[model samples]
Target chain A: MVSGALLFQSLILGLLLGGLYALLAAGLTLYFGIMRVVMLAHAAFIILSAYLAWWFSSVTGLDPMISLVGSVPLFYGIGYLLHRYLLSRLRPTTMTMMSVLLTFGIALAIEGLLGLVWTGTQRRINLPYGPTSISFLGAQIPVVQIISFGLAALSLGVLYLIMKRTQFGRSLRATIQHGQAAQLVGIDTTKVAGMGFGLGLATAAIGGAALSLQATIYPSLHWHWIGPLMAIIVVGGLGSIPGAAIAALALGTIRVLLEIPMGPTWAQTIFYVALFLTLMLRPQGFFGGRLAQRF
Target chain B: MPNDSEVRTAVAPPGSTAVARLRSLGSGRTGPLVGIVVVIAVLATWPLLAANPYMLSAGVIVLNFAVFATAWNLMGGLTGYVSLGHIAFFGLGSYGTGLAVIHLGINSFVAVLLAAIVVGLISLLVGWAALRVRGASFVIVTIAIVLVLLLVFQSWRSVTGGSSGLVVPRPFPDMLRPEHHRVFFYIFLGLLALVLVSYLVVDRSRLGQALKAIREDEDKAQSLGIPTALLKLAAFGISCFLTAIAGGVYALWFGDLDPIFQFDVVLSSQIALMALLGGVRYLFGPLVGAIIVGSALEYFLLNFGETQFHLVATGLLLVAVVLFAPDGVLALGAALIRRLGPSATSIREMSAADVRAQQDERAAARGAGAGGSVTEEPSERASDD
Candidate 1:
């Protein structure tokens, strides 16, 4: 009963949607891999970027893509400073719990500030081609969705290259493998951690930009974004970048397919039900075979 | 390296009789009893001193949060199972009681109790599966559960009234007179007292030490033949039981309920914040944290309602506390109390263990430096004890 054209269209939508989630989860997994710290404020960062894009578009008539360049580094710096000055000071055992609360506080602060500036209204960052659609294999795809997917893929590819080839990447990997060993080798662990956190925030900026195009952006969007983001990271495996990609794609595909069959409202519940089952049955994740020691 | 360090590194066998003796002593009721009594007494008399409806109303809300936070802390703080989706349990209670009243014409008291039991059983089932996973996975499982509940409550219009939510008639509609502030205030005060008493009873019992041991070192506790799974489930059930009770009370108090508000992730985060701000380690940490944070939000930051002051304050406070005073507001109070009280031997005794542990860790670090390897028995054992 499944048409090839329908399957292709669903997959295209899923892959495009997956890209945004991958971008969002990339920084979270990387941060966890390096520092074993889950920055729960990551969704807040995504929402912040959306707001940032919304502001720039309204005030200066700049596009979201242009806003990305400015917002990414700004968030990176904020994240770096947070890691260095605040998060680094906590005990390792308590780090995750405290981060959850601390980041939630940040989310609250950002949401509050956003409300003050923009009120509680939902906004959309409309690209020029937002309403434009193109036919592909007997199905239609939105231009903005395609652009967002391309942007996400390109950034992720660049990130992968940096991690695999750069000196800083090697140092980051070393630290993830054994922090004490990395520290012994004269690697400035603190500096590396800050940069890693910065990189994570930078990805969040991309995620925010991508999300604004597809969904309605608002101060409360962080609330909606956090659960799904957490689901992706956890379902993907705590610190695996590729795992996040796969998980995002899987979830995205499930979401779209479920939406068609069950309707949007039922599909939303089904998505979480799938996530809950995945987590309960396979804590290490489908691809996270053979549990590895975290640094 | 040194005899002191070696002594510190000595790993006590998990099943050893000595460790068992220590657990009994640590969990003894004598320690937190007086402090609990004084706190309950003060709370009971608070409205008499303030006597203002606004203050009483605020107090009622604060107490409600304290109860919820305390319940959350038992599972999260005590058991190290961080659940971000605790609001799922609260939602169950809210809806459970609301539906019972609206659909079945159940009495408020019976409905509330039933809601707690229902939520508790659900938590037990969820905890059994969710707690199987460690660390971040546990957090995700809880969030998924909450999300599922949120979406269900929103989509299932026949039962839940869709996204707009279901409103229940006030449990005691006659108690709605503005002049009845004293009546509601006393009810809230009683609930708060009941929560505090039950928490203390559990905390001061032997079960508390077992839970703490599991939190501190699950493997070591497991090796000692502690049925960690059962204990964790028990804690999770108790925690949910109390949280559901609070939710039911809140539903009754508000007289209106919505899926969005009842199941909001933000409210769950607020409970976690209250626990952390007060001091997750102490029994009264959530109470102290809720009072300080809640009052500051209500009184001082009302002017900045247009801005993100509350969130900023929460974030800053969390950062500050984690970096500087992870022990929380309760620790500050405890420190003040210690300075006023006569020199207690317990302080010296506790510090001795801490000092030994630190010295051993340093020695282990130095040895690790020389050999490029460390024994699991020494390092892991130190972590365990």
Candidate 2:
């Protein structure tokens, strides 16, 4: 029912879309690895950052991409302080469950605050070149998506360096593997935890800015974004960053590709169905490997 | 009952046992039941006292939510499977009733019953599937279920009426009259009564104890020969059954069934929040939560027009409850009473406080402590701080 070029174009767009998804899901997976908390408010946090990015860019007459210059550091501190003062207190046995409820409450509060301030009006970062398209292998690609994809790759690359090379990253990996065991070796797991959460939120900030470029965002728009991100992480395996990256891109492509024939609603439904099915049949995820037990 | 008595016996002085027993008995299982009965009596006759249409209308909403929360408590409180997607069954139940009413031309009341069965069977399947994964996975799976159902309901426009909404025919033909309000109020109130009695029985029975055991330690419960999985599924099914009935009744009364409006995450969270606010384990916790949430929601909708101040207010309250009073209001109330007033001087007061304080202190200790049971998982990075 469709042309060959359209299918090729969709595949390209899907990978780009998935690039954004990885950036978004990375924060959530990082939190799970460190704290075993699902961070239900992750989507709300992203939307909140998107709003802040929008406001900052509009006020300073800078591109929304530049808003990340402020948003990432700001949310890092917010995420750190939040983990210390509030989330850290929940008992570990129940932390997994309580965090979902508590973060859900936090999500509601964020949505409410955003609704009050933004009035549910959808806003997007309107770059002058946003509407322009380029012929990439004979398929039209929007400039906004391309920029967002490049920025996403840069951010993900930085994330890789931090996770693999830094002292903080080593401690975070240790804590993820074993909290008390890491502590026994003279590591301050609590400090590592706070910083890990901060790092996660920082990624969310970057992801949010990129998201606002290609998609219209509002207070409740988090609801739509959350399901897809959850599907990505769950499909990739809870704590496996590489797995999440692959799953995000694969699922993102499939969703966009499916949209061509099935329409938007069914395409989205298919993603959520995958989330449900994967979670039900294989709680560890398709490729999560030994990293499955972290969450 | 034996556990309660044995614990009280240990805490109180041997000579003061009789007095402690009397005081504690008045406030234990029977005490709450009596209080609930009197509250029901007052509510049952409330329309006669003041036939204000507005109050009756609002009361119906409270009762509807009370049923929803209370039903949710059956699953969450008993099994510790706090579902974030009970909204799926709720929406399904509403659609079931609406469809049954529309197509079969059956009595709306009968349709409600039929919807309950449909939802019950569906939940059995859902619970069977979702119960495979516990904890975070269960929560996410539930969310997925609700979201997927929402997509189906939204896209399958031919049957569901889609975004425009399925217009349900109200069982009562009156328009905004006091009589119309009273009918729903009584119907829900009646359902609440039946639900509470069944819940009270379950709460006091071996089954309830087994469910609580599952909540506290599923591995231990299973080791002890309790069919933890089956019980969880049953509780889930029962919980969804009641929630669906409430949804059906809500549809029949309100005359609309929109996908977004019915299968809402907010409503699901609100109901879960209500159960949390009320004290999930306590028999009347959800009832208490429903009254607070329902009334507060109405107040917000009325005063702050065209906005979401209510959402903000409830969200803050939910956070506070999770942070400070994870046990719920009744537990909080008992603690306060033990701490501040009714001085520990009187023997009766001493016994009551002693009995309650013992339980409260344990709960408090658990609430205050960090992770318990040396569950040193393989990768647990051994950290002191």
Q: What does each candidate score in C-alpha RMSD?
A: 10.7, 10.5
Q: Which stretches of candidate 2 lie over 4 Å from their true place?
A: A289-295, B1-33, B49-51, B174-176, B340-385
Write candidate 1's Cα lDDT for B197-311 as tens digits.
Answer: 6666566456777888987888899999889889989988999988898888788777778888888776777777778778888778888878877787677555666455565
Give the RMSD in angstroms, all C-alphas superposed, for model 1.
Answer: 10.7
C-alpha lDDT (0 to 100) for residue B284 of candidate 2: 86
Tens digits of lDDT, candidate 2, A53-91: 889878887888887878889999999998998899887
The whole-model C-alpha lDDT of candidate 1 against the native structure comes to 0.76
List candidate 1 segments past 4 Å from native: A1-7, A289-295, B1-37, B49-52, B300-308, B336-385
Question: What is the DockQ for all candidates, taken in turn?
Answer: 0.38, 0.43
TM-score of chain B of each: 0.77, 0.81
What is the docking quality class of candidate 1?
acceptable
**lDDT of each model, Cα atoms only?**
0.76, 0.85
Best by lDDT: 2
